[model samples]
Target: MSKIKIVTDSIANLTDEEIKVYDVHIVNLNVLVDGVSYIDSDEKIAKETFYQVLKEAKELPKTSQPSIGTFLDVYDSFEDGTEIISIHVASSLSGTASAAQQAGDLSKNHVTVIDSEFADRGQAYQVIEAAKLAQAGASKEEILEKIKDVKEKTTLYISVFSLDNLVRGGRVSRAKGLLSNLLNVKVIFEFKDGVLTPMQKGRGSKSIQKFLDEQVYPKLETLTVKECSLSYVCLTEFLHEQIDKLKSMFQEQVLHIGFTVPTVCIHTGEGAFAMMYYHD
Candidate 1:
C-alpha cells in the first residue's frame, strides 16, 4: 500500500493537464539561445517562439539535461514512504536518464529510473503507461517489466523535410545530410534504444508514409495494440492536416495529437513530424 510517484523530463512533450491528470512530476530541461540559458516555462516562452528563435537566431540553440541535483531536489519533496518511478528520454540521445539514475543512487528510498530509448511523444507514451500501471498498485519490479514490454512494441515514425536542423542538431554529418538531400532522398529516422537512427530513405512524404504503413505498422500488430496509445508530434501546426489523414485511416484507434515542445522543435525545425505508438 505504498504511494508511488511518476517523473519525467520536459522533452516528453507532456501537457500540463496530462501531467496533473496522471500525477506525473516533470523535470525541466534547459534551453540555451544566443548564450542565454533558461528553464522551459510554458507561461513565458511559447513553443512557437522557441522554435522561431531557433530558426531565425544567428547561433544554434542548445539543450541541457536536468542535473543530478535537480532530481535529488525532487526526490526530497516526495512524502515519506513514497516510491518513485522516473521514466526519462532515450539515454543514447540525452544524459537525463543517467542523471536521474545517479540521483536515485543517492536516495535512501526506493527509486526506479527507466531509459525509454526514445524522445518526445515516444518517451511520453512510456511515462503514461508506467503511470497507469503504478496507479493500479503494481510493484516497482512489475511496473518496470510492463514498461519493458510496452517499449518493445512501441513504434517511432519520423520524416524530416530539411537537413539543416539535423546537421545543427548533430544528428547527421553535414556532408552526408547535404548529399542525401541533393539526391532527393528524404530519410526516415527511428528512435531505438535512445538514438535517432536511420531506418530507411524515401523520395518524399508519400513514400515515407508508405514505409511506415508497410514496415512499421506490422510491428504494432505483434503486441496487441488494443490497449495502446498513439501520439503525433509535429514541428509546426501546419502539419495537422497530414495528421488528420493518418487519423482517418485508423479511425477506430484512439489517437492523441499535439505540437512538439520547444526543446524538440529546436532540433527538428519546421516540416518535421513524428508519430509514436505504444502497444501491449
Candidate 2:
C-alpha cells in the first residue's frame, strides 16, 4: 500500500491543534504590509497580530500565493512513491492551485492537486475531511471523491461590517464604500460556484441576523451537519454574542472558532465574521 500525505496552504485558516492532529502539511502564503513581507504562519505573524497590524497600518496588505518552488520543496520532503493530495483556495481568488499543479508535474512522486473552490474555513473543511479519509486507509481516488462530495455539500456565509478594506484592496469603489459606511450598511456574501457572491445587504447586525435566520437556518436544519467552523477578523463583544447564539442553535453539533487569516482580512476588513460548514 502506498503512503498518503495531505497538503494545504495557510489560507485554509487551520488551527495548530488541527494541523498537528491531522498531520497536514501547510505551505505559508506571503503577506506584504507597507512593503514588509511576512510568512503567514501561526508562529510568525499570528492571526491576532495580523489583524492588529492591519487595523493600525496606513496601507492595506497584499497577499501572494506560494511559488512553484515552494510546492516542489514540500513534495520532495515526502518519500518516493508516496501519494500526495494538495488542496488549495479557489483558483478564481488565487493562483495557488495552479502553482501546485505545476510543481506536481515536476515532482517524482504522484501528486493530485485539488482546487477547493473555497477559502478560509470553507477550504479548511475540505482539507480536514480529506485528511480523515486518508487516515482511514482510503485510496487516493477515494479521498478525491470524498473531497468532491464535501465541496458540493459545503456552504459558507460571511458578513462584512465595513467596506474600508475592500475599497483599499480595490475590490470596492471608494465612493460606494463611503456610501455604505454612511448608511451603516452590512453586506452578506455567500461562497458558491467558486465565487463570493453578494446575497443581501442590511442596515445593521440585527437585520443581517434576520437574513440569516430566514435564509440560512432553514437550509441548515434540513441537512446533517458533519462539521462547522467560524472565522473572524477581530473578536468583539458582538462576535462573542453571536457565537453564543450559534452555540445555542447548534447544540448538537461541534463548532470551531478562530481568527481569519491576513489574506482574507485584506478584503473583509475588521469585524468581519464568517460561518462555514460541511453537511451530508
Candidate 3:
C-alpha cells in the first residue's frame, strides 16, 4: 500500500485506468438531466446521453456536490494512521471544497483538504500527481510542495460558443446574452485566481481560434507542459481543427481530451471547450 492515500471529487475527470493504476478514490457529484440523475464518471455513454437529453430539455441541467457525510465516510474508512490528501474543484465553482474541509475536520485520520481551484483535467493534474508521489513513497510535505508548484505553473483557458447557458445560470444578463448568442459572439476566458476572467470576445469562432493562436500557442511553444487536455461540452469542426493543431505541439505526450463537467457547462453552455496545461 502507498504511504498516503489520494481522494478527489468526480469533477477531476480522471479515467478508470488512471484511478485503478494510481489507486485514487472519488466522491461523485449528482447531475440531473431532465429529472434523471447521472453520476459523472467521465464515461462516453453518460456524456453522449446527457448531451442528447440536454439538447431537448426545456431547462438547464442541474448539478449538486457530494454531501459532507460522504466525505466523512470515505475518510473514516481509511485506517487511523493513514494520511489522505483530499483535493477538489474550485471553491469558487462548487461547495465540494467546504464539504471536504468539514469532513476532514470531523474525521479521526489526518486529512489534508486542498481546493484545486480548477475543474475537469485541471484538478486531475494535481490529484494524479499527488497519487503518483504517494505511490512512490514520497512524504506528505514533499507531495504538498509538488502540488503547490504545479498549481502555480498551471494554466486553464476556455472558449464559449454560446451565451445561452451563462444567461440561464445568471452569469450573464438575459437580454444581452441572448443578443450575443444571436449575433454569434464567442467569448474566451482564462481561469485565473479561481475565477473565469474574460480575456476577449468577438464575432464568430475565429475569435476563439485567434485568441488561442496568439495568447496560448506561444506559451505552449516555450513551456514544457507535463499535461495537456482539451475538454468540451460539444465538439465541432473547429474543435477537431484545434485538436489537430494542439497534437502537433506535443512531441512525446498525447493530448488528453474529454468532456468538461456540468459545473463548467452550466456557465459555458453547449459547444464550449477548455484548454488546460501545466509546466514543470
Candidate 4:
C-alpha cells in the first residue's frame, strides 16, 4: 500500500494543472529555434509566444529530449527504493523514451521505464491511469497490467489542414507535400504502432472535421470510456473549439480536457487537431 510515483516527459502534452493534480513528475523537453534552446513547456515563454516563433521561423525548430542530467535530477529527488514509472513518447518518433530508460537504469531506486509507444495525450493518458492505480494501493505489477490493457485502447487522431508544415518539418517529401497542399488535400492521420499514418484524405477543413465526427468518433465510441479522458492539442483555437463542442456532447462521462503544448504542436503543424481517448 505504499505510494508509487509516476513520471513522464513534456512531449506527453500534459498541462501544468493536470500534472500537479496527479502528483506526477514531469521532465521537460528542449525546443531549439534558430540557435537558442528553450524548454518545451517552460513557464518563462508563454505557449503563444512559443507557437509564434514556431509559426514564423525561417527554419523549423529542432527538438531534443531531456538530457541525462535532467533525468538524474528528477530521479535523485525522489526517495530511494520507491517504484517510479517513467513513461514517454514513442521511441520511433523521439529519443525521449529511450533516454528515460537509460536514466532509469542509472537510478539507484526501482524504476519501471516504459516506451509508451504513444505520444501526446496517448502517452499522457497512460500515465494518468497508472497514477490512479498506484494511488489506490495497486502493486506495480497490477498498475503495469492496467497500463498495458489501456495502451491498446489509447488512440490518436490528427487532422492536418496544411501540408506545408509537414514539409517544413521533414515529415513529408517536399514535392509531394507541396502537391498535396496545392490539391487541398487535408489529411486525417492516426498513429499505428507509434507511426504517423494517414487514414483518410479530404478536400477542406470542414470535411476533415466531418471525418472525425462521422467516422473517427463513431468507431472509437464502441470502446468503453471508463475513466477515459479527451484532449485537444493543436495550433488553432478553432480546432480546440470544435473538440470542445464534441467534449460537451459526452459530458455524461468523466473526461479531462488536456491542452497541447509546443512540444507536440511543432510537429503536428499550424492547423492540426488531435483527439486522444483511452478505454482503460
TM-scores, in order shown? 0.87, 0.93, 0.93, 0.88
- lDDT tens readout by residue for model 1, 71-158: 9989878886778999988877678999999999888667889888887777887788788877788888888887888788777866
lDDT by residue for model 2 (23-99), tens: 89999989888888888874556787677888777777888989999999999999999999999999878889999
Per-residue alpha-carbon lDDT of model 3 for 133-228, expressed as tens digits? 999999999999988988898899878888888777766679978888788789888887578788988898888888889888998989878988
What is the clash count of model 4? 0
Q: Which parts of model 2 have CA positions greater than 4 angstroms off?
A: 42-44, 170-179, 251-253
- Top TM-score hit: 3
True-structure lDDT of candidate 1: 0.75
lDDT of every predicted structure (CA atoms): 0.75, 0.86, 0.85, 0.75
lDDT of 2 at 26: 98
Models ranked on TM-score: 3, 2, 4, 1
The superposed Cα distance between candidate 2 and the true structure at residue 19, in angstroms, equals 1.4
Largest lDDT belongs to which candidate?
Answer: 2
The better-scoring model by lDDT among 2 and 4 is 2
The model with the greater TM-score, 1 or 3, is 3
